[model samples]
Target: MAGVDPDDCCRGAHAAAQRGEFTQATVWDACRTGIRDAIESQLDDEQASPVIIDGLPTIGKTQHATDIAFGLDVPAAILTHRYETRDEHLNLAAEHQKTVAEIPTLDRDCPTRRGDHGSGWAERINDYRSRGASPTYLHYYLQDALPCMQDGDCPYLARWDAVEGADVVIGGPAHAALDRVVDDRVVIFDEDPGTAFRTEFDANQLSTAISTFLRRNDDLPVDNHFGLIGAATNESMDAIRDAIRDELSDNISIASPREAVDDDDGHAEAPTAVLAMLELGGPIIGDTAPAEYDWDDQLREEAGLDYVELPDGSQVVYDHAESRIIIRRPPDLTDSRAVVGLDGTPVEELWRGRLGVDDIESWRILCDDCRARYLRDVIGYTFVQTTSHVKPYSSGEYVNRRADFGLIEAVENRHETAPGVITTKSAAERLFEESPSEPFIDIQRVTNRIADVKHYGALRSSNDFTGTEVGIVLGSPHPGDRPLQITAALEGYTAVRDDEGKGTDLDYGIPDRPFLRHYREHKIAQAVLRFGRTTAATVYIHTGVLPEWLAEMVTAGPETVMIDERSEGQRGVIRALLDEAPGTAAEIAKRERVSIGEKQTRDWLKRLRSEGYVSRDDSQPYTWAADGLADAPHTARVRLPDLE
Candidate 1:
């Protein structure tokens, strides 16, 4: 027996050993031996049994096959499903530094006439025969003739006969020629071990292919020379096994497949353990032990591990052992710990303080398998939705409403485009000139928010007064439900408008005034509140209505209560006092010398506070202040009467 590199052949065998499949270990060992023997044999005799190998994605199957082919000093031809154009083939050939011939399928070329002939009685009949060529027959013919074709004879002619004579054929799953090739050639199926057997071919085509290959070659000398290796996903091995049994009777193999190693005996080797670990989720900081960490106990406990427990009490589980890692929980200790490799090298660590409690809990539940698969697949593109009227302004309001509905976290309004009802480019120009800085908000600066708006329209002319209305619209990187809070904001705007137009002749104009301003203000407030809670970021409110006096009140100190738009100075002063210090109406009445008038003030303040502008903090004196104003910068400090 030839000496097999421990790193090259031990992974799958180790997994088999864990499953207690002793026979599988032998087979795995034999497969490696066969590869080495085949290489040496090829050196001694120009023709040797073709080496066949198979496995799931990332399970080292291709690596092993490549190594074997390289060892034998023979060229390898990889047939893939993605092979399309001659350019693609040429590119792959250049990449692998090997010649590639694609199997032609039913497409535009198969039924087309090669040469133009005058359509006539005789030529028509000849054309019909030429155009009626079968794809399968052409495929077969090409496979047999292409390799020997001279340079100018037709580039598509590189056929399967060439594959048969080649040193190695690294084939992907394609049924037509593979079934026939299995008879005289060494064949390998590079499948994703995690769910390779679950492929459509296994469910439908594998049985027929295997049976046909077996039946066709029955008469040939029973040479241990022909090898069959099925690469299984470490994650979905059970599925693969079931697929195999579904295809053939259980009695075909030497014995039921077994684990290639003994867990208690640490001598099993690292590559096997590494494969098992990769299947679970590649090594993780604080979750997986360094290779140097004595793994005797771990190996024993996870003898057939569906999950692995690290020293810190966090557990890493395997979902699709062949493809993903799912981190279930990190160690209990908050010490910044990470996953380390066998060489005690740190891979990655969970971000401390960056994640919320819910996110932390979620991270813990992730198993090794998902992590491995997802780490490389994380999305790189950042997407933002844009529409005509639905640009940044209305979109910001929609985002705020979404945040209220817990659909998003924050919304920052950047700019506003004039309502689409304005006619003429000149009118738009005028509106923009009046509010030049209010075009569209740059979406890049905002985080965790949705963008949505009311509607889009094109103006007829500058003087056209009929303001056409439209419904609300939304856009985002990913789709989500429309927020109900936005509807409430719209309703609030409508209520305020109806109240304002209580006795006006131009009440109809009320609908045309664009309810966006009301919506924008409310959304800004909401965004500020959410920002404070989620990211601990400051919220700056820049508005024309935000009085300089009120700015001073908030800026001087963290004042929770803000009262503005008051009609009478007395009422405003009394209300502001009571807001700064909440108490019974009777106590306020005594202080203000107003006979139960303080009750009315108290009632108004209570209503305003309930509307989300102000809130009461738990203090001995029971202080009240603006809720969303927590992070508002102190642009101006207003002197208020010391109510205490």
Candidate 2:
């Protein structure tokens, strides 16, 4: 057989890996080509000899660097500032040696004691020994340690020297030391500390550090050395650039923002293209494949659907709109008694009843039986009747029985028998007659239950004793029980409550009266501070669930209208614009609705615009421009002289 080309092998292995079939060896083989490409790109510009591989966290930056170094037959070293002490570097060297030898070794114990072992001097001595004042150290040690090795017994001194002389250094935080090394030596700073340092340090301190370091080091010839700096954080580069500009002035030349690699056409890779390619594939493989199941076919079958497989191997299917499995019905034995008419007629007679006199009761029983049969057959249970026209029970009475039965069991069995049996007046009358003075009567709760019936439509009656409709019918009122009512009250105990439920009505009570008063005053002050001077237009203040004080504040001024808090943050922007100029309430209302009436902008601009204050020229309508106002320069400050 003809020998398989390396590139061909690589491509095959890569494809297999993409399909999740490749072994580790095969993946490495395929990855070599990409690595070779990366290395070649790094080498192409000899003047910028060292290649900096940059990527976000877990984007395979370290692996990519490893591949490039090994594939290109170039030395790669990871530099890090985390190994700050001499001991740290010694430990790192030992770890690196052990790693290269594939030998299992316990991690070096980090010295914690202050007296002897943890002292800087002892660490320096150990550093010297590890860098090979000891005979057991490898020859690569001398080669790696020569450049930074001070002419002393320090272990890492040699290794540091070698690092300074080496073609590449890959590590984090160690980049700060790069300024001491000759510029021509290829110094690759794998990004870490420099990025973090920027956030905490002032710009001037950063500039001074860079200047001092650069001034001490002489530049190596361009052909002899190259500099590469890899950064994971974009902020790092920004900070570095600012520091460099401030420190080095015109001496340092920074490359413009460009993709780290070039494409087939020799143009630099577009930033987006590099990102897309780097993120080409989906999630990493853990020990096992994702917990996914091929439920499409099963789901389709269950839904009474047919699947059609396309030529492209994709499948299309139509599923059943409803369930196919029919429920088993209850036994129709004579002993199982069901109410027939409103007057307790037998179910058997109700089903075969007379024309006019028994029709309504008969139909009601038939409907109830049908619903019960459906529930028993489909849902696998006989529903217990909770309400009936013959023996009408108040919601409270039903609830008490439900409580006696334990809520869960009651919910499982309860059902409405007759639909549309409860009218709005009846519901209201029931509520009004049932201890109106009771603190927790919950009239609103009952009203909501009635509203739910209207919302779902006339397919089911409101007062039926069938579980399906009754469950829904009672849903709105059922939550008004003490437990649920208390929970709701606790949830909404936000220091303000109207005496009457109607928001428009002025009947109000402050449960925590003092706290409410203080809150209102604070809110008014905030509003005043937010809207400085430009008034005459509506300013939306978004304090959710308007406090009575805020309402009073708005009422105090014609220019300020306290609309519903629901219209706050979103509507504030439009309100700010309206405040700038006179606009009809209709226009304001329309604008508010369009913007969802959240007064975020109004909250932002309230301090600048007062309820009646206006700009010097009223010709232009006050439009809230977030960016415009933020960007405007403050040339003069107008203050009342006496107040100042």
Candidate 3:
């Protein structure tokens, strides 16, 4: 068994362990043993089992994966969620004296038939693809119509060749195209694979795919395979799901021609429609029978399906309202030597239910005391949330109405300097539009700016807000009620609709809370990590849900502090008395005639202070002063008679 030495851990984890914070240390030790055991146990078996490292965020899971990739004697592949993350790990590998190649994905700048890059080429190619042009058609079209790809000296192909024998290969979730490139090699998923495995397509795209198939095989008997889909789009959700499943079963025999071995890498060519059909809801079988005729002029064959695996645990459901079909299945990892997944919040049911993974080993920090001590003593964080349930929809209303209910003001008051705001991009835009002046950093112009605003989805794999001393999470990034219920239903959990039709009760009679909590709280934790977990920072959450791990570290429980709605005349009178001389609330109230007692005056002062209009000191009398006007002359104080 391999052991993880305290000093061998990442800097943050090492420091935390040295400070007697056992969460990271305990997790690191478990990961070291568990990962090795899982790998070794699989080496002797014909098929390798997956290993998931579910350590807390910033607990060096990525660092550990990097070491494993570089240290392994066999070839390895690392798949990240984004291109930026791949580059980050590439740099991390450099620190360990390992050089790796990044397999780039296609974008607008990729070469087309004309060999031109950017807007013109992108627009032309997009227009062509929008008409249902297959990648094979586009490849042949570019070859005959242009001068660049005729010789087949493509930069994209050359990148794959460059990383041919390298010990490590880094890229994004598009690794399905790699096929045998990662076969029988250890593959590491740097984050949750849920987003990578899930596929979402609207009705229009599905119709276009069916039309593309009809254009090629007009006389074929495959019309029934897609004919019901159009009618299903108008039906109920259950009907839509059943219709698609029936079509998938009907199209099971509609196989492509014998696969042709391409010279570039022996990859089989399947028709565009066939690819789309299988992607929609295909069975997990490996091979299909040869078709009677090939669609394209180029010889095509039924390639052994090595891309997607829709086993017993896969889910296929139709979103009727959106006219969309969502499929959640695991990627085909039949030939991978071993698989390792790293995620901060690893929901095992999600892995089994949504991702369709069955044989997997997980390592996590199970001790509550260890985790709480690590967060409170080692990370040094202060967690606070609003008493009110700031639902996802309410966030937009709060910003649009300019009524944050003192949530924003209280967060601002907690920090001495400006704090970052993490909410929906719509709410952030509204905040920008309603602000009195330009923000210190423009959220639109430069993403790497020291801005005070960061939307929820944009905070992944970013450290730009590390300098931000505080973070005010405005609301939970809940993916609405319907989506949550759909996910819960897909996970085999029953969802009960409300009588009013306003919401759903996914948790009704369920042994535990539904996937809604996991989905929402995972996003909240991701948002909080933007403050740089290694550094000491405070986070004020206005969201209704708080993850159990974070809830343990809450120094200030949820409580509402409404800003006093006193008239400007009464507020000005208190400001006048404070500016004249810093005095106790009772002494100041004695001088002013606001028809309020000392206690009421004190409450009003606290409200004003929270709004940055007044300051109070920790003394026997608790003296109050108009902030920044304590030294002002008598002329600065507005008399009660002068109030408008």
lDDT (CA) per prediction: 0.28, 0.26, 0.54
Worst 10 residues of 3 by lDDT: 635-644
TM-score of each: 0.23, 0.21, 0.69
Cα error, candidate 2, residue 476 (Å): 37
In candidate 3, stretches whose alpha carbon ends up further than 4 angstroms from where it belongs are: 1-38, 44-48, 96-99, 108-118, 126-141, 146-152, 222-315, 353-356, 393-395, 398-410, 434-451, 489-510, 560-644
Q: Rank the candidates by TM-score, best first.
A: 3, 1, 2
lDDT of 2 by residue, 1-644 (tens): 01123443234333454666543333333334433443454355432222222111112223444434333344443333333322233343442322211111111221211113346534443444322132212113443443222344334333455554444443443232234332332222223221211111122332232233333334411110011112112223444333432332232211111111111111111211112111110111112211222223322323233222212111222212321111111111121111111111112121211100122111111123322222233223211222211111224342221111122221222221212122122332443345443222233333333312221122111122222232222211211222221211222222223446431222224343323322232222222222111111112221222333233333223122111111233333333453344343233434532443324433434443442222223334444333333211111111211100
lDDT of 1 by residue, 373-413 (tens): 21122211111111112223222322222111111111121
lDDT of candidate 3 over 472-523, digit per residue (tens): 7876665655566556555655444334532223343345554665667777
Q: Cα deviation of 567 in candidate 2 (Å)?
A: 34
Q: CA RMSD for every model? A: 27.0, 35.5, 11.2
Model 3 residue 449 CA deviation in Å = 14
Model number with the top TM-score:
3
What overall lDDT, based on C-alpha atoms, would model 2 receive against the true structure? 0.26
Q: Which should have the higher TM-score, number 2 or number 3?
A: 3
